[model samples]
Target: MIEILNPTLLTRAAGTGALVADILHTLKGRSTAGTNLLDIDRWAKAMITEAGALSCYVDYAPSFGRGPFGHYICTAVNDAVLHGRPRDYALADGDLLTLDLAVSKGGVAADAAVSFLVGDGEHPESVAMINATERALAAGIAAAKPGARIGDLSHAIGTVLSEAGYAVNTQFGGHGIGSTMHQDPHVANTGRPGRGYELRPGLLLALEPWVMADTAELVTDADGWTLRSATGCRTAHSEHTIAITADGADILTLPKHMRP
Candidate 1:
């Protein structure tokens, strides 16, 4: 379902977005060499509970996944990209980690993700991949505004990834988010401009740009949730929840310190 949040709900959305961003920021700081993925999930649970919010993932049961997620957050490392279920493995130096989080508070939900290298690893390729996704996400956000079409944002994102020499995967991409986690108006990573749904004020969209180093194909791990690159090449993902307004798109998931 597509939801155009009212002014009151939009205010609540900003709060939820801040919580999501803060949780991710804290998790990224805590994740290092020898840190267990399960620990990250536990941390997420505690923070969410403390904030009096609900996790959109714990009870998330979709056709693609094995069952209810049963996890607080998604921890993707190295080759893994989307729907990464937290496991018992400890991270190593130079490991690329992606933390995706979604939460609801005051009856509104927000979602975001960030990919970064663990420890003081000098992996240039991983850094480049992460930068590319971040740049692509910015491009998508720049294209979002009242009267702008969804394809415009997708095209902007795809242009950045293609230019970075990374293959784009369409199996999973950004989507509308509001009271619930995933909503309608599926936003693909790549599409033609001037096509698809037109943007409007009060519309909330989670724009994510993810890419694999070599191929666009993906292989699901034995856990039946984590999606990894077919070639085992490193990957990166960047995302943010944006609200369309009269002036432009307002990024709701930016951390408190990063907000204007």
Candidate 2:
């Protein structure tokens, strides 16, 4: 369902957005070698509780996933891109990891994802993958504005990925997000402009641009969760929740220090 936030709820959305951003920044800082995936989940749970927010993913269940997610955060590492279920694994130096989170506070919800290298390994391939996703995410956000169709945003993102020489996967892409986590208006990573849903004030959308280095296919892990690249290529994902306002599109999930 698509939702338009009222003035008061939009204000709350700001708070929710800031909280999600801060928590993610904290996680990135605290993560290091030997850190367990579950540790990050617990940290997210604690911070969320302290902020009086509810995790949207803990009980998330869609046909594509195994069942209830039952996790505080999605910890996708290396080849793992989506539906990463935390387990007993210690992070090693230079491990690429992605953290996707969604939380609701004061009746409004915000969702975001970030991918980064774990340790001091300067793997050019991994570094490029992460940078490309971030660049694509920026392009997608730049294309989002009042009256712009969903296709515009998709096209902007796809252009970056295609130019970067990576294949786009549609199994999962961006989507509408509001009072709940996922919403209507599935925004594909690749599409032509001037099509799909039209933008309007008060609408919230989570625009994520993700890509695998050399493949568009996905394989599910044996654990009933975690989607990996079919060719075992490195992956990257970046996202931000944006609110459609009369002024323009206001990005909600930005790191406190990243004002740009």
Candidate 3:
């Protein structure tokens, strides 16, 4: 489904985006060396409850996953990239961690993710990969405007990753998000420009740009959720929920303190 928030509903969506961004910001701050993945999930759950919002992940049971996600946040560490189910593991210094969260408030949903090194990891390759994803995400957002095609966003994102020496994976990418969570207009990380759905005012899209260092192939962990690089190469992901407007694309999922 392609959801276009009406003026009144868009107001509610703005709140949902703020909540998602706030929770992600808080969780990122708390994640560090020796931090348990479960603890991060707990922190997110508490914050969501305190805000009177609902978690889009807690009961997310898509056919691709084992069962209901049962977690408040996705903690993808190092090799792990997508659908990372929280487990009994403590983060160590130099570990690359990705925190993805989605929440609904006032009947609207927002999703976002960030990847960063746990402690001070000065590995050049790792740092480069992280930076590339962030750059790609920015490019995608820049291409998302009224009358823009999904392919334009995809092409913009792909250019960054490809130029940075990383391989793009298309198995899972961004999607339309609204009141119920995932929606239509699948946004791939790489594609031809001037194609796919045309952007329109009031449309909400979650543009995520993720890349694996060496291979585009991925292997699902035994857990049936966590996706890891086939070559165990490092990975990074960056995402944001944006809404189309007459003015341009408004990035709704920016943290309150970081808003423009």
Question: Tens digit of lDDT per residue, candidate 2, span 1-260?
Answer: 77888889889998899899999999999889899999999999999999889999889988888889899999999989987899989999999999999999999889999999998878899889889999998898888888999999999999999999998998799999878888999999999999999999999999999888889999999877899999888788998999888767889999889856
Which portions of model 3 miss their true places by more than 4 Å?
A: none
- Those runs of model 1 whose alpha carbons end farther than 4 Å from true positions after fitting are none
For each candidate, what TM-score against the reference?
Answer: 0.99, 0.98, 0.98
Query: For each candidate, how many residue pairs have backbone atoms clashing (under 3 Å)?
Result: 0, 1, 0
lDDT of 2 at 149: 95
Deviation of model 2 at 255, angstroms:
1.4
Q: Give the lDDT of residue 48 in candidate 1.
A: 100
Best-to-worst lDDT order: 1, 3, 2
Rank all candidate structures by their TM-score, best first, as comma-separated numbers. Answer: 1, 3, 2
Cα lDDT, model 3, residue 244: 92
Clashes of 1: 0
